[model samples]
Target: MALSIVYGILTTVLTATSWRLGLAVDGILWLVFLVPIILAVIGIINAVNGKMKPLPVIGGIKILK
Candidate 1:
């Protein structure tokens, strides 16, 4: 989420400064945003199926004690 926000801010700044660079970075933004969504889906599926598995990338994140 933070990465997405940072990237979005960067893209906005870049766009304000240079349209071309911003456009290029914007193309890659989809990938950055897709990761969290995919992870969430995976987590939900795992939970529904009664499996306790670690998620890729941020699975180790301890949101709750």
Candidate 2:
């Protein structure tokens, strides 16, 4: 969530300053955004079966705790 927001903001800033850089940043951000959704889906499946599992990659970074 926070990471997505940060990427969005950075992409916006880069867009205003440099179109090429903004496109590059946006592409990278697109990939980054998918990670959370995938993790959330995995988490949901785990929860439905009565298990608590952290997401891979970004799971340990407790930003909102």
User: Considering every candidate listed, which one attains the maximal lDDT?
Assistant: 1
Q: Which stretches of candidate 1 lie over 4 Å from their true place?
A: 1-9, 58-65
Model 2: colliding residue pairs? none
Please report the TM-score between candidate 1 and the true structure.
0.58
Q: Give the per-residue lDDT of model 2 (tens digit) for 1-65.
A: 78768887899999999999999989887987787799888888898999867776667888885
Which 10 successive residues of model 2 have the least lDDT summed?
Answer: 52-61
Off by over 4 Å in 2: 1-5, 49-65
TM-scores, in order shown?
0.58, 0.51
lDDT (Cα, tens digit) per residue for candidate 1, span 1-65: 68768987999999999999999889888776787899899899999999999877877899899
State the displacement of the C-alpha of residue 50, model 2, in Å, after optimal TM-score superposition: 5.0
Model 1: per-residue Cα lDDT at residue 13: 100
Deviation from truth (RMSD, Å), model 2: 5.4
Model 2 gets an lDDT of: 0.85
Residue pairs in collision within model 1: none
Residue 31 lDDT in model 2? Answer: 84
